[model samples]
Target: MSLLNSLKWKAELQAITDTVDEYDRPKEVRTKVRDIYFVEIGITAEEKYLSQQAKTNVVRRIKCRWDNTISEKTNGLLIDGVEFNITRIYVLPEVREMELSLAYVD
Candidate 1:
């Protein structure tokens, strides 16, 4: 597809891993599934104002592809040493492509 050709960023798709620590407490970890290169990715920031608190927060939007990988809402994407939390996933018909909505962790 022509959209795939415009992809310029490379990123790793990671899934959540459940584990128990020494105390037997449940813990969630992220493990990399694979590296996807030539991916079309874009990060943008928007200022959100909270009228009640008179505060503003910078929200970042991360757009990328599903890349045929099994991804869920719990999955995270790592790009350029930055980790993003997957907010939502939009899949197209035939499962040929997907759009990920992400928010920056930091």
Candidate 2:
């Protein structure tokens, strides 16, 4: 139960798709679904460094409601038209809050 005003940016949680390339190799593609939303974005000092070391280019943490339509294995977030790969999902103790660790996709 945090204040809602901090959640400023609107985003979309996208589902992952597996498709074959011209070389016949499997590639994971993310497609935006109908489930778009507003979410809170934050960045911690520790998290920033850890992501940098991991070479994931993760610049922020995103907080949003839990959606049955998405999961860490099958979805990512699109915020401000920037694509981010979801590296982890942390569900708060109350199960009402979901925090995602996002890695920028270039």
Candidate 3:
């Protein structure tokens, strides 16, 4: 199947916004920015070994169309009511797509 056809999963992209409470204490707020379609990719043996060596709990990898709004400050993704933190982002400019490395949150 084509890549676009394979992108069947929809997920919410979230970002952290800093806000101050009434008492003037700073707080981190997670807000949904947008919904995106992605295709989940299986973790390979090399990636698993590297993640183990790096002590990173990478549990999922996904690919989606390039989104300019995504940045380093982007918090995490919500998929099927489960949250996953973005461990790394690999942008494929030639294809206008991005691969996201994710780890389970909590």
If scored against the real structure, what TM-score would every candidate get? 0.63, 0.75, 0.80
User: What digit string (tens of lDDT, one per residue) describes model 3 on residues 1-106?
Assistant: 5778888999999887789999999986778988999998888888878877888878999999988778645678999998888877889998889998888875
Error of 1 at 2 (Å): 1.6
Root-mean-square deviation of every model = 5.0, 2.6, 2.3
lDDT of 1 by residue, 21-70 (tens): 99999987889888765454443333233311333222344444545555
Q: Candidates' lDDT values, in order? A: 0.61, 0.75, 0.84
lDDT of 2 by residue, 6-36 (tens): 5566787788888999999988888778655
Once fitted onto the true fold, the runs of candidate 3 whose alpha carbons sit more than 4 angstroms away are 18-27
Pairs with backbone N, CA or C atoms under 3 Å apart (clashes), candidate 3: none
- Candidate 1 clashing pairs? none
lDDT of prediction 1: 0.61
Best to worst by TM-score, what's the order? Answer: 3, 2, 1
- Return the number of clashes found in candidate 1: 0
